[model samples]
Target: MNLKGKTILITGGASGIGLESAKQFLALGANVIITGRNKEKLDQAKKLYPQLTAIQNDVSNPDDALKLYHIAESLGGIDILYNNAGVSNPTNNLAKANDKITEMAAYEMDINYISVVRLNNLFLKMLQNRPEAAIINTTSILSYVPSNLAPTYSATKAALRFYTASLRNHLEVAKSNIKVFELLPPLVATEMAKGIDAKTITPETLVKALLDGIQKNKFTIRVGDTKVVYFLSRFFPKTAYKLINPVKNSIKLSA
Candidate 1:
């Protein structure tokens, strides 16, 4: 759980929450390596944080994932693999007959859920060998209550939520030194959340809570509205559903 002197590899680290996490992790005296699909953004991130090791990688690509592992290995391997890359297609899935619905859903699933599993499987052995290591998976508040406007995205996060929990339990049962941490964040004020009229928390605030949770050995790190939604979703499922999909935000499906 101790981040100091540890090497952490964060996916989608060019901007938003990932970039903020890299900045904060560096401040904690940890070696931070970031990967993203955009080469320009990666360069910019490197320019901003000279200490960051930014690499161009698409988490959805299996080849890139393998290449990333080799690159990390060359850099002495990573103690923390932060699966922070995710995509949300805000198009209402049931609104109309869209030919690309399956494609969009698949894309979100690959990056948000499948890629996490891939990265975990790739680095699990390395993490187990370390004295202290962790895998951080970023799920959303939508995992607790589905969002009608972003149904596919919600489903992906929900799937990731279950996967993270199962992985954590599996590791514990096997007496593995690798720690699995699930970060459930509410609507964050990032480029991804733009145009979504909802109360949001800054990336700095969310990552701060995440780091605090990791240090405290809290496996499930829920931030801001996520905590309230978690509680409500358990006892007041209807209210939780309403909160996530208000009347104004509900979609009307075509007949």
Candidate 2:
């Protein structure tokens, strides 16, 4: 959990939480490789942090994840995998729900859910070669409490939460040294939540807590006010949905 000399791989590392964590990981003296879909943004990030190595890859694609693993193996097998890439499609009230609407949600599932499965498989073998390994799955506060605004996104993360737990149980049964972590991110002020006024947590704060959470063996790390949502939903699952529906409808309205 110290992660001082570990090799790490992260998706969507060009911006937001992914980029912030990359910066922190580099400062901690770890070998880090970041992946992003935007060539221009990746170049900008590289210029900002010349010590960082970046690859242009989208995690939503299994093929891309395979290619990324191949690229990493060529360098060195990663000790940590950060599944941070995700997407949130704008809501629409159209009767058809068209491909465009579903496309982004599907992208979210690919990155938020499927990419972890793919990378874990590719690196699980290599990780088993080592005595210790870690898998950090970036879920959201809405994972437990569905967000109507991000219908598909929330469902996928919820599914990922269960998947993370199951994977951990299996790892325990297998007596593997790998650690599985679930990150329930709140409305951080990252570019992804730029317009929101939810008192975003600084990148430094989030990463510091994240690394600390890993060291403390925290299975689920809910940052900031997100912790409230997690517990409330657990106790009043039905009422939580009723509250979220109105907010989501408002977002759809604005859209």
Candidate 3:
């Protein structure tokens, strides 16, 4: 998709991957609106990239999502919706026998999975009206291989991945011009991923790859080692789980 002159809305765009992506989109001649729950972070992002239109929004809230949609609509509707808002509690503990689900886990599913669905549905019609449009959802490498350290996060992403695929299929069957793209990034060096020490890609690198993927019309864009994760999951799911689960186990042991 040609990003030039398009309006793009990104959730959690105050920092990390979302911030970098907003910068890139602005650089590519797109009008970018970034939303986050934190006002300080939004201000910080705006200070860095004065071109960005920062909106204080919590995607997990349906009301906030509706407000966001109306805000974008006032700008003549968004050409791209980047669903990137997410949380991760990268704790060392894994679920034990008969352990009940925690509040944090439930919150993860609400924000990561439910919010994405809500926002996508809210913006689908607006996107279809545009000459060219896209919905980019950020699902992680853990979407395929469960992370022992962040079990809830992994499960939420996995659910998101499945939903994204189904949404793509639905759009295709309807012959819609709107494109659906999924970004799978592996171990990005971000504040959200601080505790897990691993070889990581910078947010800038991931955003660059994402822009290129969009131009090439790659439906599922896997950045860095995520491509390997996708391949492993497709061919050797057991091996993929074994390979990733140990990293957290080793970290737990060391701690």
Per-model TM-score versus the true fold:
0.97, 0.89, 0.94
**What's the number of clashes in each of the models?**
0, 0, 0
Error of 2 at 8 (Å): 0.8
lDDT of 2 by residue, 176-195 (tens): 98999988887677776754
Stretches off by above 4 angstroms in model 3 are: 97-100, 247-255
1 or 3, greater by lDDT: 1
Clashes of 2: 0
lDDT of 3 by residue, 7-39 (tens): 999999999999999999999999999999999
What is the lDDT, from 0 to 100, of the residue 195 in candidate 1?
87
User: How well does candidate 3 score on lDDT at residue 114?
Assistant: 94
Clashing pairs in 3: none
True lDDT of residue 99, candidate 2: 63
CA lDDT of each prediction against the hidden true structure: 0.93, 0.80, 0.89
Better of 1 and 2 by lDDT: 1
Could you tell which candidate, 2 or 3, scores higher by TM-score? 3
Model 2 misplaced regions, further than 4 Å: 92-99, 197-199, 242-255
Model 3 clashes, total count? 0
lDDT of candidate 2 at residue 178, scale 0 to 100: 91
